[model samples]
Target: MNIAGDDMAMGGMHDEGANKNKSFGERLVSWLGRVHTMVIHFPIAMFIGAFGVELFGLWRQNRDYQRAAHVMLVVGALGAIVAAFLGWFAGGFYLWDRNPILMTHRWLGTSIAIFGIGLAYLATTYRRAPDRSRTVYWGLLGLMTLAISVQGFLGGTFMHGGLNHLAF
Candidate 1:
């Protein structure tokens, strides 16, 4: 996909000419990478909302909440998988300039996607079971949330400058 050229193209965001010589497939890859920025928010919000819904369901003994959480978890996980690959493509296009922060962000981002899938699987398998333990569910959700937070922080640093921006 000529990621090196992608880096160049991204460096000049307004250079329409930069993409002129690239093949249709290369252009499609670049377009998909650009979609990463827009699609990433969906999984973040859905995961957090799913966790909240599950917690409320547990508190109130509401089956509807459980069902909603199960659906959200599965959907969010699938969306996260898509976002993860798009993020990789986007990162390839980025001019990281050898910044280690980017490497950390990339790995953590991938982990978040994997964790999302695991959580979704757990949610699905236990969805129809009345004997499922709330503690285990909550614990897994907490861990996944933590991973997402860390990934978000690293991504923010890359976008906003200041690696330890959260130190305040």
Candidate 2:
């Protein structure tokens, strides 16, 4: 209820963005934003795990490992969709020009989500991929995994006030 800076000065309310006038859906989204950070880890872990197992599968020439990777990729893609949706809520709607870090993080996360889903579809569609196509798929998965790492870095930079957060 206290949307003004005065109540925040007294440590009365933690959420300064709260608005009593907001509709049910609006408030729901605002509340959901708080869960974004927690949900993001699921997809990141899933994707990284997928990439690692895929590499091991290729190295060992194992069909089991490849199947596991495909499953992981699908799950990771689903998680990414949820994480990115919550992230949009977390970052606020269309404030792209107002904050550079948020903008980059937001778009990058979104791209990953889109790309992840596409990759998942392709992976599922071509379960018994030929050698060449499978190779290209693995390469794309590697790139997506790399992008996830960069997204994590950007998120940290935004939260901890830039790249010097780890300064000695």
Considering every candidate listed, which one attains the maximal lDDT? 2
Q: lDDT tens digits, residues 34-124, model 2?
A: 6787799999988999899988987998767877888998999999999999888777667453567678899999999999999988777
Summed backbone clashes in each candidate are 0, 0
Name the regions of candidate 2 deviating beyond 4 angstroms. 1-26, 130-133
lDDT of each: 0.76, 0.78
- Show the colliding residue pairs in model 2: none
Query: Which residue pairs clash in candidate 1?
Result: none
